[model samples]
Target: MRTVESRNWYEKSFGEDYLLVYKHRNQHEADRFVQRVIEWLELPSGSRILDLCCGAGRHALGLANAGYRVTGVDLSSVLLQKAKEADSSGCVRWVEADMRALPQDGTLTNSFDAVVNLFTSFGYFETDREQLDVLKQIWMALKPGGRFVLDVLNAGYVQDHLVPFSQRKENGVVISESRVIQNGFVIKEIKVEEGGSRPRFYTERVKLYSPQDMENMLKETGFLLDVMSGSYDGEAYDERRSPRMIMLGHRNL
Candidate 1:
């Protein structure tokens, strides 16, 4: 099975370097993203949830506060530490692990009622097989009747309005953005300006995926494709106009 060998640019870009910046400006947006998922899932109170790629435990803890028993998993120790610190209700369980291959015999194998791959966390793999492997891992972790919700970007729409380059800075950090023409992926170059220290820069890349491609992957993993929308508001997906693509699938019982 193909696995992601090293920590990708995101782990570094969003690690200790950019966490504060994200928390300051982008945190509310993250929360809003989770709220959208919660609404779409319509999960009940105390629902068993596994949040894959649960960064900083924002979504996982948010769901827990709403009364869901949430277990969050990620590969970043620093982010997971922040997650553990922010988990006050004891409702959220934080695990540091790879999403492609989870601890099956450990805490996560076939052990959740709902598995979430939110905020466009589905397409980081360098190849199609690796991406499929990640889906299979998610498939195995869910209970027979479990559900999986994915919030991903609409590649077609993104390419249409694709910004070739942009820049933004806040909270003592500056972010330069660019796109890779080869794959039409977005790359963000972040630089932190600290006193008496040289500026540091890290990069993050996310592949743009089509709805049909994602649905096929889910079906290949034995999940039944349930819903697909363009945005968080339950609108129809136009592929050319929608800013976001959100999909919900279920594992066969």
Candidate 2:
């Protein structure tokens, strides 16, 4: 069940301040990740791609630059505007919508060759059923032979390498973060402060799901589990030490 307080945390957390807090994330790194995805998936040059929860639209833009048809979707209007401004040529299609319900009822159904949910976009909801519903939506949004890439944190590694507190200075702002794993969810409370402006706090929560848990969800969603990679370099998944759990699933042809 979702709590009233937690219900809208995401809406509050992803705002103008978010751009400042995460300013270090750049297009170069995103382009590298996009290149890896292209080689790993062996996707055609003009394949259609849906970048779900695409904050700032870097990866989506990279795919579009590579001659792929891309649609980037995110709930934050603030980030969407940044994405639109970055697209000077206006190549990629940007849509502001929640991941749970990607807009356009029948228009987007079976409309994509591949869907990429990157950087721990999964596990925002408080319930398992709600999270599974997202997978169902992705499954329905793909063509019969389409592929799906779910990039998420490795729960085992997170638990093993849990950092309690951290601090960093970026762009004249001091950022402090306190992290804790409670009730099977990894929660981070971030505080950003400038010299004069008041400190702004944002909370991010991602539920920890095991590899078996992800497998079960994909199987239930009707996606044929294909590969599970631990790193963007295409190494095999090692639950205990891997930094990421990137699963590749296929829709039955």
RMSD of each: 4.1, 2.8
Error of 2 at 207 (Å): 0.4
Clashing residue pairs found in predicted model 1? none
lDDT tens digits by residue: candidate 2, 1-253: 2224554678888888887777877888889888888877788889898899999888999999999999899999989999999999999989888788777667568999999999789999999998998898898789998999999999999999999999999888899999999999999999888999777778899999999999998988898889999987878999998999999889877
- lDDT tens digits, residues 72-155, model 1? 999889989888888765668888888888886657878888898877677776788888988898888888978888888888
Poorly placed runs, candidate 1 (over 4 Å): 1-7, 24-28
lDDT of 1: 0.78
TM-score of 1: 0.89
Relative to the true structure, how large is the alpha-carbon lDDT of every model?
A: 0.78, 0.89
Displacement of residue 253 (Cα, Å) in model 1 is: 2.3
> Clashing residue pairs, candidate 2?
none
